[model samples]
Target: MSTSQTEGLLQQLLQEATVVARLSGQAIISFAWLWPIRGVLYTLLHPHVILSVSRTLFTSLLTSAIIFTVLAFFTYLPQAAFLSIFTGPLGPILALLLVGAESVFLVTFFARALFLEPALSQVFDTTLVSRGQNSLVRDGKTKYASSTKKEGIEGALVRPFQALSRDGLMKYLLSLPLNFVPVIGTVAFLFINGQRGGPGWHTRYFQLKGWDSARRKRFIESRKAEYTAFGMATMLFTFIPLVGLVFSFTNTVGAALWAADIEARENLIESPRANAPNSPKTNEGDVRAKAE
Candidate 1:
């Protein structure tokens, strides 16, 4: 890269790092943005939301154990040996933690893809109903209803991929190499991934709002700090093996509760964007025109 390009890259990384440090205060408020704790409480009260966990628990644990052992066998010794160059004595413990985290991440990613989509959508919609945002759920069902194909939340699941973004997955894969940098590298990996993880918790809400990409971008950017904090928190909580799978559901409920609150406050539950006949066709153009 040229001098200008290199300088620009450094500036970008610094800006991203600054984002976490700056907005974490907003996240500390406990009830603002996506209050993850609320999700846990909500799940505890509603046993149905956690039904998805029971289904995936065995598979998630088995896969985690298999991956953990494999990574330990092939990677632990070398990764620890490498870290010893820096920490000397702490290398073995650190390497074990890193391997476990990596296994959890991989299992969480694939396991979510294979089994969690339909169940998660149900969780969000169920929470929405509890929040008295039943109309929004009806709207989603009507919009996606097809006698020949799948109906209701099933249709919604494919578009948002149960809140999993392909671009985000690609970014995550690119970030995995960051683990090689030792301790700072591990922190960077978590921080970088957390940037997207928080916003991901809201994908269902965005879809329900019928938000175009530009509009969703604007909303998330406006509250980037809060989103980053939430994402970082999710990453930390869900970074554990086997147990992280449970946080995944809680976070979904939390996002739904947050979405319901937004709808209630803004009267957005009955908004035209979600109800208008041509919303799907016009939203992108409308968002661009407003931006201009």
Candidate 2:
């Protein structure tokens, strides 16, 4: 290529990179960052959350510790080595942290299966009530609730699932290699996962509101930055091994709080119509559909 042409290409690439970096910075600086702190404070203020989750606390930690030990034994050295290729002296320490994070992530499947899921649902509902949205389950309708086909809405605002599916875990595994490139790699890993996870928390909300896929997509697209911010904050808070256990509930509270706020604002604009809840209805098909 000619010298001028190459220079032009290089300048264009640099501009794109700068734009991406600026957007990333904005995403990280949102009110969503405070959600984790809100979660922590909410946990302390509401013993109900702690009580509900405490049933499996010992089992969850012990199980996580065991899984962490075994996985670190087999994978630590290799992971550290991979990280060291790009991180050099800091690699081992970062690898140790990542392994711990992975162990915690893996054990969530068991923890959720045994107790965490229901506890989170309870926490979400409790937070919703506290935030003045009690009508979420009452006669099944309120000005603050979605006016769509929520007749089938039940339980919490989110459907239950393990941390990530095996396929998602494999994708996460693939992303881990990004850690080889130091700070940028780690940010990429977190950002990618956070992006998906942020919105996943609201499938039930979307369905409860009776939003079709297109409307839901537009709503999410408009707030993509904030959602990613929430997700990234959630990932970081939950990445801390044993501490993740508590953060999990707090994060749910935070998301519920956010959702409540959204509904509240929308309710102001919406006419004061009410729809009753289909309290007995189940949401297997639509929930999964919206989530996908």
Candidate 3:
């Protein structure tokens, strides 16, 4: 990334972190209301989360199992081996770090596949309604809601898995070894995993705007720096053990807030001539009256 891009990303990261922090209390309440029975019941009643879970469960479990197995094998390696670097006095610390990282990764990995779409749908609806925007679910048959009717939920859910299966799994597995590389390894893992998590959070935004896979891919690619920063912040927050669950919920809310901001910016850019105070149309009218 360029210097300006890096700065912009850092600024955005700070902004998002602030938003997440500010809204942490609200997030806790929301999560509590949705937890245990309510969340599952809502999913059962809605096509969004249900479809996402169905599409992602197999792949997510497979990927997670593979990762766990690899980690298990490495833990059994000889003391003189490379994996043993994180052993001895530093073993507990290293174990905690790995567990934190792994927990964040697995939770986010499954969440992106299963819950993100529904969460985004729910969040975007709430955002637009609050802003007085005309937000409709699929087919315009109903307002955006928990039970909004969305077409192609199956395809939408499957796409992420396909992408993950293609190469994302391999990259994730490879990143585990990086945790052994002292300071550099952890940083690298954060960035790499953050990149993986970024798109998932942004997926709902793209859906809200009715963007297709191609457009979504292009847009995310263009704004990679910004999303990486956002994801990195999220990954760090999720590393906080018990509190990570709260952060995870807050991250969804934060993602929605971020999407709302992006949507607002896009609107301004697209309608600049219409919304401008002194545009060519106004100027031409004034000139014609003066000529008359």
| lDDT for each residue of candidate 2 in 61-85, tens digit (9 for 90 to 100) | 5665677778788998998898788
Cα misplacement distance, residue 189 of candidate 3 (Å)? 0.6
- Candidate 1 TM-score over all chains jointly: 0.69
Model 2 misplacement above 4 A: 1-23, 139-163, 207-212, 268-292
Please, what are the lDDT tens digits per residue for candidate 3 over residues 28-128? 44332222233233334543432433433344345445554554456434322444565555544555566656654565465555644443345444543
CA RMSD, predictions in order: 8.6, 10.1, 13.3
Cα deviation of 86 in candidate 3 (Å)? 5.4
* Candidate order (lDDT): 1, 2, 3
Clashes of each: 1, 1, 0
Question: TM-score of every model?
Answer: 0.69, 0.71, 0.54
- Looking at model 3, residue 221 earns an lDDT score of 71
Please report, in order, the local distance difference test score of every candidate based on alpha carbons. 0.64, 0.64, 0.49
